[model samples]
Target: MPDGPNTLLDLNQRSREVFRQLVETYLATGDPVGSRTLSKAGSRTGGVTLSPASIRNVMADLEELGLLSSPHTSAGRMPTEAGLRLFVDALLQVGDLTDDERAGIESQLSGSNRTADGPLAQVSQTLSGLSHCAGLVVAPKRQARLKQLEFVPVSPGQTLAVIVFEDGSVENRIIDTPRDMPASSLTMASNYLNARLKGRNFDEAQRRVQQEIDARRAELDELTTRVVEAGLAVWSGTDAVSGSAGRSLIVRGRANLLEDVQAQEDLERVRRLFNDLETKEELLQLLTLAEEAEGVRIFIGSETKLFSLSGSSVIVSPYTNAENQIVGVLGVVGPTRLNYARVIPIVDYTARLVTQLVR
Candidate 1:
């Protein structure tokens, strides 16, 4: 495939119209467009004022330029992924979403909950229903502020650290302590953390507490320090400590991909896509990349290895919190032929709606 730089300006007016006609027809029918079909087509269907022989020449030129390809089964041509990208970047006409559509989106997302990972399941499910694609969401990573931490002797050599957060959620971690250890050490560890961990999340508390401990500023015995360290370490990967949340990946409506399946190859592609979606860790990692992007991002087939085998596409946009801070991302995953002009605004509008609701 030719990968050198190319743009719409390179094509003459006839070539551009033929390319546009071919792509729009193929996208509408999920079938190849034949030169004869374009020649006899009516104006509404983007009929070109050219003979079949002339249209075939244009098709050959587009194929040579790597903008179109023909399936072995037929002599018709269809746009390649590169061609689709060019069309989206240049020719696609995206109109504003209707007032009813915006109101409907707002109606669906209006809820009272407020947090980083708030109401994601509903949001994704709504996208799937509307777009007829597998809806995906990446919940914001958030750590609740630490409220109180307590140590209680559980067994001969085990102790439980009862962690409480400002959000009223409690988690217990059991650690090993000396059988004859003084109860004063547990009390001392509790006093140290409760005083230090109340207002801060585990990450902030770790930094401050460890700095003080390193500087010998904390008035704690060695055993008590070990107890404190153990509690902190146990919470390392939890939402209380990690930068990403534990429940961050949400995928809905995998079967919606089958709605457009026309052939056995289409079924096979959906099967592969299903497998990719099932791999939540990798998919979530891919979606998290959108968190770093400015606005809507389109990942066409072969652009990302995760969906390369399936020949799928992902259209994502990051949603923001009240302060215009990007908190998470949400979007749809579907076939490359998904109506880009239509769905781009949907994803963008949904992201903005989520931003308003999240705040």
Candidate 2:
């Protein structure tokens, strides 16, 4: 075995071919691959013709190079994380998804509008179910600039804050008015804010209103300002319902993680990974890797801390809107020994399909 990080670079042609073939087989099946198995596999050209003893010597060399690990009982070897990365970057040959797979994806993605629930969530769930892996999606921000506001009295002290965006999407939040504040006062506050902010962005309008309040320039009582601030706070905080640019995450197939054979060691780690996926913020941070990546991004074991504990892998791709702007991310999470050659291209194609559908 070579002494350093450049070990793979120093390997002879035959040894390199043998290592690559072993890594490929191990990736396809999460099990140790023996030399005899390689010899009898018939997939390789003429590289596997060596005797079993000769192949074992090569396997020992690969194990020393940090590319393969030999189990105590089995006379076979499996690729390590470093080995998998090398194979993924230099040795793996990714193939295109078949037409049947594409049609199945299309059929699953089409279920979004057929139900009352959000389409993006449906897409995420469907992707997870089809892949037999965890699926995640950053939901699209559908809210546009706020265009109009209306307040209607639903009860004595409660009014519905109807917010209309430039995109024609509308949302309402029930706000509690001051017990002594009259309906007329609420209308005055609504009108004042609309006149100053009808054509402006929500965040910008919020900042301007805050500045005005700070300067004591707007002619209004403290109570009216309080009511306006309360209404805006509710709207801003619930961006999902209001269609603002706040982040959203949906994850499915967490149960698939438990099926991993290696996860039997300290299952708590996998539990943390699953729990982290539930929160929108933490999940967004994980998906943020896809934002900076070009096309598709693959995180194979220990490449990211969020997934390191689970000893899992993630493949993500960004999906864009009609304007060619990246609107969200979609991807799958599975065991590290997953079929990267197959899944990588599948994920890349799924990202493109999602972009087309959203457009």
Candidate 3:
């Protein structure tokens, strides 16, 4: 091993080979790799001809360097979180999705035949099924362009602001009006807004409506003008107009976390993870970090604060729309022992496919 910033690169060829074998074995079985096991396994791979005693010495050295650890119950060695980071960042050779895997992913996202749950939900389900872990997708906030507006009078001082979007989604918000407002003012405001706000997003529609009012093109009495302004304010204030005000975090395959519990400690960790997933504010913040990066981001155990206690890992990627604007994030969460080589490409491809279909 070498000192300074180049520690990972400075490992001797023998140490590197042995370390790689150990990490690979641990990832595959989620079990500690003993010196005897590494010696036999490495000899078969034609990489390490060292005896068990020599292998044990090397394992001790790696453990001292904070790359591996020994569980209290076994003399066998397992990679630490730092070791997994080093492996993922520098040592692991990522694998591509097999043809069958690709077909499976595509079949789940099949166009026109997808379920009523929508594409984002379908993608989450597909990823969860393929990865055998909890899949997460932060759906983009709905911002449909306005098609028409209506103000149906419910009572003397209440009116239902009906908003129709170009995509055919309709939203209704009840707004208070002056008790003495004339019934004819509803139609007046509706006509004035529909004339200029159609086919525009909230911000653009608001700007155009204001411009018309400033230019005096909105010919209405003071009360009718105020009513129109209030109607616009309702949609502009929040995503309530699109009926998705709260953050949309789709998590599927939560039960998969239960599949690999080896002990009481493992069970506790899984339970903590389940609790963490329920309080998604942290997960949403974690996923937001991926939006700034370009491709798949791997967060090993303790790297992300939210999953630190559980010692879990997350692999997230941002998905964009047809305009190439990042609209949401999608990924999987699993134990630190997740199969990165196989999961990385699966996540990347799923994100790309989602981008294409989302538009």
Better of 1 and 2 by TM-score: 1
Candidate 3, residue 138: lDDT: 89
lDDT of each: 0.84, 0.76, 0.85
Candidate 1 regions exceeding 4 Å error are: 42-47, 111-118, 150-162, 171-193, 209-247
**TM per candidate:** 0.82, 0.77, 0.79
Please give, for residues 206-315, the per-residue lDDT of candidate 2 as tens digits: 88998999999988887778778877767654433433245567787778767754645537756766765755565677787788967989888788877776777888
Between prediction 2 and prediction 3, which has the larger TM-score? 3
Lowest-lDDT window of 10 residues in candidate 3? 238-247
Off by over 4 Å in 3: 1-7, 111-117, 148-162, 172-197, 203-247
Candidate topping lDDT: 3
Pairs that collide in candidate 2 are 143-243
Q: Which candidate is the best by TM-score?
A: 1
Off by over 4 Å in 2: 1-8, 42-47, 71-75, 114-117, 149-162, 166-192, 196-245, 259-263, 266-270
lDDT by residue (4-71, candidate 1, tens digit) is 12788889989989998888788788889999888888344546989889999999998888889998
Candidate 3 lDDT over 1-359, as tens digits, reads 32222356767777788889999999999999998998888778886789999989988888878788899979899998888888888899998888898888877887534433477888888888889999999887667788999999899899999999898878888987998999888889999888877888777878887888899977899899988888987766533432233346889999998998989999999999999898776677788899898999999978988999999999999999888999899999999999899889999999988888888
Better of 2 and 3 by lDDT: 3
